[model samples]
Target: MLGFINGFLRRRQRERLRVAEFSSYWLEILKTNVPLFNRLHSADQEELRWRVQVFLAEKQFEGCGGLTITDEMTVTIAGHACLLLLHRETDFYPELYSILVYPSSFLVPVKRDFDDAPGIVHEGVDVLCGEAWPTGAIVLSWDEVCQAFSDDRDGTNVTLHEFAHLLDMEGGEADGTPILQDHEHYREWAKVFETEFTHLRRARRRGRLTVLDEYGAEHPAEFFAVATEAFFENSSVMKQQHPALYGELKGYYQQDPIMWLSRSDPVK
Candidate 1:
């Protein structure tokens, strides 16, 4: 009963925040920074606005690497993040409460084990644009975010890539599997993802170009995130080149970007 009461209270609070009017200034920020926002249907645009408002209200933003967080930065990040939740019923990333932003790619320390040595490891630094922790925070580079919007169809958005990790992590692990509606769906998801992942790995080994990025070959979690970036940014190409993968993503995201794009550009 106590747990239920807390959940209920939280839901009410979220609802109140959702109902609060979003300022026109933030709306303009989204319009100016995010080209994808202008492509969404009117209804979806309205829904996204509410979701962004709730997200901005719920999640805390902090600046790093001499970057100062601003309303434009907050709205731009939240707007893209909220795009994933547009067609779904969600608690708005229940495990995420904070976002950390950097001016550009940030360096993170990494330790790698040597294959020849039994337990010896080498420490190094990796420059990364974004990262999402399982149940805590998301870190991103503001420059990358701006570049993603400017590129628009490059199938690379640091924001979407990291948030996809958050979605995959919802099942308590980030092994590329997210919570599905049923057992049958899970079976199909596993089958399709495995097949595509293997195919991409093989393609990379052979030095062949593929619709999905080669970075997806790194891990299953990365595959899902990279595929998500492609699913939204290069939907038409994905639908044409990898129909099965596109179908599954369409089912999961509950939106048809191909159709949306066609509607937006009927001429071609």
Candidate 2:
């Protein structure tokens, strides 16, 4: 009798916790790229909110200086970051617990070179709004993130770009690959990525325009990151330009944004 009573109390407690956790709607997840806000299906939006709540329970956020980081701010960041993980199970570095944010533009060190240069010297610091290194360090400028959410340009989303880098780095190397499930997946991935990478490189060399950014031609990793951005934000264009690549991304991400676009006339 006592065992039955304890089990019932435990189940009740779990239910109560779930209800309390999801009762709030004004979560930071809502402050996303306006397009993402309008494009997500109702179910996805609810899922995002739930993920944000759970995410908030897991991650660590540090507001450098005396800056105040609200639940809204943390949720806003995590919500978008979670979008990359929505379709798959990704265990990003458990060390990736800290998120460093600045009030505005921050100075980060970088390498630069003049003409006739294969290698660059550590010239000075770069005035960047955001940067993400594969070792679980992410730097953000709050101002730039806000502006990026509002900007309608297809060319960029700093947070998305940086987070995409993290995804690409989940594999042994940050060489534009996350972990794949099987050998068959790896074989297919290699074929698709190499073919697509070659195509983009040729396009950039020939001065041909691409749906994804030409900066992708810089390296294998950049190609993957840029392809990811196009896959999510400008999905139809990605589909129109590279059907195979789009199909592969759809397979990996499970969510077809092209379908989302077609379903909602207001989103496009």
Candidate 3:
């Protein structure tokens, strides 16, 4: 009984926080820093604002490598993250609690096996701009996030890529599948994704310039994340080049980013 009461109280507190009005400063940051914000319909923008407020209230942000966490930084990050949550009934990434930001690309340890000696292994470092752990946290480089905003058509947003992983992991694992509306949606998702993933791999082997990043050929999870980036950042090309895949992403995200592009101008 006590545990139930505590849970209820916490839920109530979070609801109150979500209802609270957002700050004007945060609004300015979205207006000035995120061009995507301008492309959203007024209703979607309002919804994004509420989602951002809830996200900022719930998640912790920390700076690394001599970077300082500022309102601008938090709002910018929150805004991009909330874009993924806009049309979905989400708990705002309930499993993710923290975001760690770096000034630029950071190094992480990776393991490799020796070809000469099967039993021997060594640790190497990989320079990365972002990573999304299954449940705990997301790490990002602020430089990459800023670059995404400046060059929106590049189909690369570290923030979107990481957050998409969070979505993929919502089902207790990150195996390229996320929570769907029903079993039918799941079947369709699996079918379309597998077909497209196979096609991408084949295209890469043949040295074809695929619409999605070749990095997606690495794994199914990576394909989902990379496709999400292309879906939002380079929707026109995605819609034209890969119609079926684009339809699947459109159905999942519930937003036609191509429409947003049309409203602004032809995406070159």
lDDT of each: 0.89, 0.72, 0.88
lDDT tens digits, residue span 23-74, model 2: 3444424634445755677777666665555556656787865668876667
10 residues in a row with least lDDT, candidate 2: 23-32
TM-score of each: 0.95, 0.80, 0.93
Q: What clash count goes with each model?
A: 0, 0, 0
| Candidate 1: residue pairs that collide | none
Residue-level lDDT for 218 in candidate 2: 91
| Residue 50 alpha-carbon offset, candidate 3, angstroms | 0.4
Q: Give the Å shift of residue 47 in candidate 1.
A: 0.7
Rank candidates by TM-score, best first: 1, 3, 2
Local lDDT at 234 for model 3 = 92
Can you write out model 3's per-residue Cα lDDT over 1-268, one digit (the tens) per residue?
9978977886787678656888888898998767788889888988888888888878999999999999999999999999998888887898999999999999999999989989888989999999999758999999988888887788888899999999999987888888986778988899999999999999999999877999999899999999999999999999999898899988888899888976754221
- The RMSD of every model to the true structure, in order and in angstroms, is 2.2, 5.7, 2.6
